[model samples]
Target: MDHKQSQIQEAEHAKRSYGSLLNVISKQYGSRDTQYADFSGECYKAVLEECYKKAKIDPSEVCYVEADGCASMITDAMELNSISEVMCKNRKTPLPIGCIKSNIGHTEAASSLVSIAKAVIALRSGIIPPNMHYDSPNPNVPALLNGVLQVVTEPTPLTGNIVGVSSIGMSGTYCHAIIKQNPKVKPTKEPASPIDFPWLVPLSGRVELALNTVFEKIEAMPFDEEFIALAHSIFKTEIKQHLFRGYTLLNAGQQRVHEVKPYDGAEKRPIWFLFSGMGSQWTRMGVDLLRLPTFAKAIRLCHDVLLPKGVNLLEILYSDDPNVYASSILHSFVGIAAIQIGLVDVLKELGVEPDGLVGHSVGELGCAYADGCFTAEQMILSAYARGRASVEATLIKGMMAAYVLKDVINFLGLGYNQIKDQLPPEIEVACHNSEFSCTLSGPVEDMKKYIDTLKQKGIFAKLVNVANIAYHSKFIKPAAPALLKYLKQVIPEPKPRSKRWVSSSIPEALWDSELAKYSSAEYHTNNLLSSVLFEEASAHIPAKAIVIEIAPHGLLQSIVKKSLSKCTNIPLINRFEKDTLKHLFQAIGKMYLGGIDVNIGNLYPKVDYPVSRNVPALHNLLTWDNVKGELISSFMKNKKEGSVIHSWDFIKIYDKRIQNFLGYKINNMEVIPPTVHLVS
Candidate 1:
């Protein structure tokens, strides 16, 4: 042969050897053959006829043939032709034939042998191998192959009758046959028992050498209980060593081991309720509250509707005008407007809500709404009036600062009596945040004096860096008269109390009498003039109450926890936890359905695995110029020789190149190339 021809021959020889090896492995693993391009219909018929003759079986007497490896080629062609011929001639009585090759790939050299073996085993066990990977045949191939052969792809009982198997090789070089009936094996009976020795010796250890002086000799034992016990002893020793190693590793500083306490079943579990609040709002407040269907309808039913009185509630709350502040009205208006409007909407959404509603100052308006003392519109209007009135009242007084006091009551006691007596009539205590903290508003002189005294007493107090007037104090008392007048004329009459509702404001429970009392002008005036002692309210309800703090930030939640140690607990649920309105609704639904531990972490779909990884070499070969050309040349030559070459070989060669390029130390023998059919 010429050099080129010599190389081609070498390659072909290697390919045939590989195919042969695959066949051996397939047979060993119990694989049967189906049709392969390499084996044609004529070739299969010739081989099967030869097998029948060798087995001394007549064609008519042969009940079934479990044909493997190129077996489907003949069967398919015959079926397709027979169907067409039958339609034309109206004939019948074709021999029954089955192809196991359709289930597994062609086993090549051992193809017929494997199929015969499986058939024999099936005939003995009364089971059959399935024909797998058969969807539809190519149009170029005869359609007779499409559905002619009835190959059992699932486990099936055999009739313990005679069966036939056949294999055909390239160039009609090889064929095999087998004839078998059923043979049975009986099951063994033995009870399981524990081994006496608990320690296992490592393979590397010499028991005699380790024993040195003290050793005991044992006699030869059969492979029965004694042998099994010895094996178990060795296994146990290995396990013990492994456990020691694990313990050492765990004690190492690199590992972080947590001491987990088992759950105490007796511990009482508290009911968990997640809370949501308003979106972060700026500029305008309560404007949307007037438009809500629930709020609008409720406001209309109230006794004295305040919203229709030409009040520009939005502008008053949103504005930063010095005039509004000069009159000491901005803070109260904004606070009340935020609280009432926010609460009204929140209550409508909640319907029947938590044990207690916790608000961050302004959120108290929402609490009041839950108590049924104020309709949504009335709350918004009242807030607007409070803001305007407070701003007007605090125009001359200095700004208020939220002070963190070491002792809130002491701070309040020192200032409430003394500051009230000394400061101008315009100053006041805005909010009682906690027992130890309070916000104060007054003229600059009085504020400076109070701060100075607290500092000297070793109390840490800082001014809240805010622009609005100090609220809940005497600073806005002047505006209280006007506020009370507006509320008395415009505030809505109290609605009937609902058992489903609860208030953070009252301790016993919300009743019409209590709500009506707060709704009166006198009570409204007192609320405007005096600071809200949240510490006092918190002390009343000292049980585990669900406190939902409504605000943009967690500041209110933190304050509630610190102020109401007896009532509130940790992991305080808020609007931000739910993040979105839809999620908030879902959380509420889950809560109502009693799924307290529900968590919604991620919502995106998982990514899919890429197919390229499975056939990297083939993929690379397709993309590589040199590899592709070689593959095409090989394929074309094979076709001319009545044989087809596979692209998988090129993929394997390219994969080797890739491994070398990437500096991988993998053995070439370890690399498996994909199989493809090459017809000869």
Candidate 2:
């Protein structure tokens, strides 16, 4: 490798070594200046002795010593010389001693660890560590002494636990650690309660304090059912707060309060319940809803509509059948079906109805059904037709995607206009997802080629994943004809408007009167093919309107939020799965009770969900407070065998506290800080 590459590799190796050591070392050792200190001969010997004891090895078995360092080369040499002197003078006879610094310039703090670690492995594997930079020893050390310690420029043989290492920090502290042959060790004992309640807060600043507080509480409190229940409640509240209002800590001594007085003049508008899309489903969805009589009743009503067409919607949804959800099409159908059914069931049970409703895409069908603009049969039939048409159209014609530049329309100005005219007549923009991103649908190969040409010109373009078929593109125009034909065959019926529903096909929200114009057979054919005027639609809405997305994925929510940020501050809601519903309810409840107030200590945790048993390790790692106590606890618990001994209960509390402070389960990466040392 070239010099620069070699340097980079060495640096990276050093970093990994440091990181591993930081993860395993005792917190006291890890936090001490010894990691970065300059060493005295005595300090070096003491460190080596500690390593030998920790590894359960006798010094007599150590046949060689190798040391390296950039900043403290002479100091390390003296230390190693002292080791040799101790061996001989104490009647242990003699051992070969060497230093890599005599060859390559010291690797600084990394040098000692690297050289010594290599020496340990050499002893275990029957090889020797090389001295790369050595030409001649310092004149201060006798030349005859060199004969006793071979100046090795090439690999040498080693055997058994025949290696010993010593490292000194620039600050006069030293460390020695031994590396031994791999040992057969038993697995760690499992915790009494395998599951741990980990915090999921997101703010970094508050994590430490939160964890500290939690650790103290957990340690003091008895582990009982009541305690667990309280823990669960606290966990749930915090999660809810974190999800709704991102994890944030209050500024020191800052306080703000709001006062409200009752208003008498105007009538309160009925609440408009917002439902979510997909991307929110988890296992055992709707189980909580089953507990609510109102929700159960609503599910029954949905069963009436969905079951007749050989769609056991609930069974299809709840069944642990992987095959059914293999594609976006099936996933979307199940997601939309479950949500719509759940919403209808919940509303019916509560006897609380919506004032208006709007679904982004497939959600629109649900809205139509809920609004009484179409019968459940008509809505499902329309949806099925739409779904089939979409799937087929996508299979035949391809899709288009663009990474828009800032001020997208202006950036593409002439280029976009020119492409629009030259493109296959079937292509059209489908969804404007973001200000700088849009999706297009048309010929597959043609779109690819078009994107490539743009990319060659330094314009960013790529296709959306999972959306292989273009829905809103002109290539699907032929499917429109089929849809039109299907719509004509279905008999129309006039129904009451139970709630207001918005149509993406039109700029204005659809009321009972507007339904008549779209009832015509021709409107379905043409309107279905045309792109929605989202910008115009956004402008016509109220600033504080609560816009709930009813699509399969929460993609529409993201789109609407990005597009309409300026016009309205509406809280967009998605009603996809049960967690989403819980979140939505929490949001609504908060808004109803009072506006959200973000106070650090006042924040509550979310309820705990039953996660897999395998999650505790990750959670512990992520949430563990890096405070001295917690760090020490973790080090003792997770260290290599014979490193340290600590109580299991203490470690568990420390782990939980760390999780609470971090506001999430710990990830493995979070367990060790960047400053940690991996090598002795």
Candidate of highest lDDT: 2
TM-score between candidate 1 and the true structure: 0.38
Q: Least lDDT summed over 10 consecutive residues: which range in candidate 1?
A: 240-249
lDDT of each: 0.40, 0.44
lDDT of 2 by residue, 1-680 (tens): 01112222232222111111211111122335455544455655555556556666566676666644443447646665666554434334345556666656555546764675466346434567666666665554452265544555677665444455655555554555544432222134422432221211222112334444444434333332222333333332223211111221111013211112111111233344334322334334454445334445555555566566555656755666544543545444444555565555444432345556644334555665666666555655665566555565525746646455444355342223344565555666654334444555667777777777767776676455324555555556767766666666653544443425545555454434454245344444544565543434344455444444433334445455555454222232333543443443333333322222212111222223222111221122234535656433221312223122344333243575345434222354333322224321
**Candidate 2 deviates by what RMSD?**
23.0
Model 1 spans > 4 angstroms off = 1-352, 358-362, 392-399, 406-430, 464-470, 496-521, 540-544, 565-680
Distance from true location, Cα of 420 in model 2, Å: 5.3
